[model samples]
Target chain A: MIALLMRDLRLAMRAGGGFGLGLAFFLIVVTLVPFGVGPETGLLARIAPGILWLGALLACLLSLDRILALDWEDGSLDLLATSPLPLEGIVTMKALAHWITTGLPLVIASPLFAVLMSLPGAGYAPLVLSLLLGTPALSVIGTFGAALTVGIKRGGLLLSLLVLPLYVPTLIFGAEMARRGAEGADTTTPMLMLAGISAGVIALLPFASAAVLRVNLR
Target chain B: MELEVSELSVARGGIPVLEGLNFRLAAGHALILRGPNGIGKTTVLRTIAGLQPPLAGRISLDRETMTYAAHADGLKATLTVEENLSFWAAVFGTGGIDAALDGFALRDLRARPAGALSAGQKRRLGLARLLVTGRPVWVLDEPTVSLDVEAVAMFVRAVRAHLAGGGMALMATHIDLGLDEAAVLDVGPFRARAAQEDHFDEVFL
Candidate 1:
């Protein structure tokens, strides 16, 4: 599992764009929203939570294609499938790699994203926390979409079509928690649900990803 | 030890490909699967390697499970040649694939990314993955598709060495692999029949 994770990290790094590209794309989206919404700081702050969540989701979507497509193209996916290691382990490791390259950076850079929207100091912690709990689910669930579409030619648009609907619950709750936190309200309920969603995906999505990959390869 | 498949059947995309197929291979034994393209040669390898579910039958590799290598080379293009070998080596619980790489004359290319390698070089890399796995049974599909003659000889030499070391190989190849009197299993002979009538021409022929 460690070896697979390292290999993924190496690939992302070698690809020369995953980490920075996601972060920059996310930053651009967050930065551009304020311009479009008018330079009203108060308005930006109110919409900040939604903008940030939306940016995160879009950033994740941008890079999801690379998740399985690279391996499928280069033949690594086939090797990993046939390895003695369980498919579940392989899937978990892949999600972890995706998180490190895209999710972790987006989460880490959220404060800058928060500032761009003129978000208050209070909402910053919860914004980060919600992402920490929610993005794993995004990565895991996105992998299933990647697996399902890995065999299709011109699969990128189709992949988003398959995955974005499933992403709604996470995005809604994550953005809501940030909204409540910004208003100095308790966010425990939505935050816990977000955490639960992440845990569930981490545990169960691997089997689904594995099954879909086997189907796609066939 | 022998890898045995009794009454094996496989289906793909909702259609039956092979049915009631039977074969066996012991250490130092090689079985060549001969068939027309798209006739399930690759599917048969996938079944024995445990990548695909067999619709019916059992596959026992040395009375254990087996390993499979496909024509796609199963390599990460981003990783160096050595990293690819080491990854599979670690998975298959083998060591010293440096010798296998060196034997294939891939020593200098060890640090090169797989994407930079030519077609034949990539195929050699794929074969090297199987070698590094060092499993008791090998299920290979089109093991020599992109090789030049020299690389082909290198592959033949590698297979010979593996068989000599008490390993069993099941290879699906169109061209002759030049193995010494391998026990060939012509999968073309075992066609599935909708009714008994489909077998009339086959039986009479």
Candidate 2:
């Protein structure tokens, strides 16, 4: 499993364009929001957390179809299914790799990017922490969408459509807490719920992804 | 050692492709599955490999079950050829990496990504994965599909060698695999749910 994770991480990094594209997309969304909203400093600071959360969610969705789609296209997924390692383990490893490449970098870069919209200093830690806990769930849940769409030739738009609805609860909870923290309000309730969602996904999503992959591959 | 399939049936897109097929192979023997496209030769192999469940049947091998290799080759293209084999070898916990590589004659291409291999070479690489598995039963679909004449001969040699070493093979192929005493199971005329007594194992002649 360590080997599979290492392998996917290397692939994501070496792909040269996919990683940069995702990061750039995240940055562009964050950078472009201020322009649309008139560059008003007070308004920017007020909506900073929501903007970051929304941008992160969109950026994560942009890359979800690519997750299993490439592997399926090139026949690596078939090898994965036949490997003695259960499919669930393969899904987890792939999801972890996705998180490390796309989600972790977004979490790390959020604070720097947050400043683009005049995010206050008080909100930085919780914004980063909430993303840290929540993005893995995004990656995990996205695996199911990827699996279902693995056999579909033109599946990119369909994948976003399928996955976005499932992501609503995570988005609501994550953005709400980040919004509270940015406003200097108590955020314990929403943050805990956000963490719970991540935990539940981490526990259950791999098996579901594997089951779907089997059916699709069959 | 014997691998048995009893009353195996499968459907594709709601149509029955293979219905209640039964066959068995003992150690040191080979069964050539012959059928046309749209038939269920590949389906039988997949079902035995545990990838697809039989609609109604059981597959047991030498007091145990078996593993399968479908046409897809099941490789991670981003990884080096060696990494692909090593990952599976580690999973099966069988031969060491060095031995598996040497056995497949893949030492030179260890650093080459699987994506770089040609179709014939990819087929060999796929077969190499099965070799590294060290499993008792080999369920191969179109094992020689992408190979050249030389590679096909090499595959024949490998299977003959594997059988001599007590491993069992259930292979689906349209071409003759050059087995001296191998039995052929004509899955074409044979319906999916034939009785065990109805099975006839005839040499290729």
Candidate 3:
């Protein structure tokens, strides 16, 4: 499992792996919001949490196809399926790799991107916290989508259609937590729900993803 | 290790492609599946490899004892040859890509990225993966799609050595693999017939 994770990470770092594209898209989205919404600080601060959350989600989505498509294309997925390692473990490692390559970077760069939207001081910690707690769910859920569409040609649009619906709960709770924190309101409920969603997804989705992958490979 | 396939049936797109097939391959032997294109040669190999469920019948083998190599080479373009082989080795809980590199004559290209290799070189790398698997049985599909005569000879030598070492192989190919004693299973006779009479049976019932 560690070997698979390490190899995927190494592959992501290499050229054409789209390592920095997610971060670049995040930056571009956040930077464009102020110009489109105008430079009014109050309005920017008001929508900052939502905008940041949306940007992170889209950035994560942009790279979801990378999770398993390459392996499927190159036939590594087939060999991996027949190996001693179970498909569940391979799916888990893929989600972990995707999180490391795409989700983690979005979290790390969020604070910098948040400034462009004139995010309030309190929004920073809550934003980072919500993202840290929530992005794993994104990666996990996106992996399921990737597995489903791995066999199809031009699966990107279809992947978004499949995964974006699943992202709703995470986005609602995450954005709510950040918004409540920025407003000096209690954030316990949304925060706990966000963590619950992440924990549940992390615990359960690999089996589903693995099952889908087996069918696709067949 | 013994691979037993009894009355196996396989389908593509919900329609049966091959049916009522039976074969048993014992240890230290090789089986070559020959047929024209689209006759389900790949299907039989895949069914034996446990990649998909047979529509009907049984395929029994020790799951951990088999490794499959499909048409695609499964090589990561960006990684070096050694990195690619070593990754599979680690995944299979085996080591010694040095032997695999030497077996495929890939020692000179060990440092080069897989994307830089020619078609034949890539196929060699793919074939070399079978060795690093360290498994008793090999299920290979079109193992020699793009190889020169010399490369083909190298593959034949590798299979002979594997068999000599008590390993078994089941390959599907159009070209002759030069395994003098390997049993051949032609899938042409096993092609699934049309379902023209199923409606009558259903109506009578």
Candidate 4:
């Protein structure tokens, strides 16, 4: 399992761009938002929680296909399937790798993007916390989507379509938590909900991903 | 240990491709599957390797007892030759890649990324992965596609060494590998019946 995760990290790093490209896309999207939404600081701050949440979600989505598509293309997935490791282990390691590569960076960078939207000071911790919890769910769910469409050629658009609806719960709870935090309101409910969703997803979604990968390999 | 397949059936894209196939590969031996392109030789090898479920019958060998190498090399282009070997080595719970590196004569290219190697060199690296698997049964599909004469000799020698070390190999290839220890199984006769017969099976499913 560690070997698979290390290999994935090495591949992402060597593939050039790695998480940097995703971060750049997030930056561009957030930077463009204030321009498009008019330079009203109040309005920007008002929408900042959702914008940052959406930006982080999209950034994580950017590389979900790479989690499995590259392995599927090179036949590594087949070889891995035949190895002593179970497919569930492989899927878990893949999602973990995706989180470390894409989600971790997005979490770390959200505060920087938060400032761009003039988000209130109190929201920073909750924004970061919500994303830290929410992003793992995204990676896990996205792994299932990636596994589902791995065999189809140019399935990136399909991957996003499959994963977006699933992201709604995470995005809503995370953005709501951040929004309430920005407003100096209580954030306990949304925070717990986001954390619950992530916990449930982390514990179970890999099975679905592995099962789907089995069918794809078949 | 030996691999035994009896009355095994496999398919491609939901259509039965091969049926009632039977073959046994014992320790210290090799079996070569012979059939024309699209004759379902690959399907049989995959089924035996446990990559997919068979439609019927059984393979007596445990899946853990084997390693499979397909048409694709499964090499990471950005990883060095040594890095690539070690990755599989670790994944397969093997100790070192020195033997695989020596077996494929990849020492000279050890530091070079796999993407930098020529086609034949890449193919050699791909084939070398089998050495690190540490499994007795080698399930291979067209193991020598882009090899030159010398590389082909290297592969043949590798197979011989594997068999001598009490390993077994099952491969689907058209070449005359000149291995006297290997008995060939021609899959032409096992090809599934025409469309009409398959429709009956499909309806049953």
Two-chain DockQ for each candidate model? 0.51, 0.36, 0.79, 0.78
Worst 10 residues of 4 chain A by lDDT: A14-23
Q: Which stretches of candidate 3 lie over 4 Å from their true place?
A: B195-205
TM-score, each model?
0.93, 0.90, 0.96, 0.97
Candidate 2: the clashing residue pairs are: A79-B74, B19-B192, B19-B193, B20-B192
DockQ of model 1, rounded to 2 decimals: 0.51
> Tens digits of per-residue lDDT for model 2 on A113-167?
9989898888998899889988988999898789879989979999989999999
Q: lDDT for each of the candidates?
A: 0.84, 0.81, 0.92, 0.91
TM-score of chain A of each: 0.97, 0.97, 0.99, 0.98
Model 2: how far residue A48 lies from native, Å: 1.1
**lDDT by residue for model 1 (B30-140), tens:** 899998876788888887776678888888764234567777787777788998888888776777888779768899899999879999999888888777876768788
True contacts kept of each: 0.62, 0.42, 0.84, 0.76
User: Which candidate has the top score in lDDT?
Assistant: 3
Tens digit per residue, CA lDDT, model 3, B17-85: 788999999999999988878778887778778888889999989989999999998999999999999
Query: Which candidate tops DockQ?
Result: 3
Candidate 2 residues B167-191, lDDT tens each? 8888888887677677898887655
Question: Second chain TM-score per prediction?
Answer: 0.89, 0.85, 0.93, 0.94
Cα misplacement distance, residue A191 of candidate 1 (Å): 1.6
lDDT of 4: 0.91
CAPRI tier for the interface of model 4 = medium
For each predicted model, how many residue pairs clash, with residues at least 3 apart or on different chains?
0, 4, 0, 0
DockQ of candidate 3 is 0.79
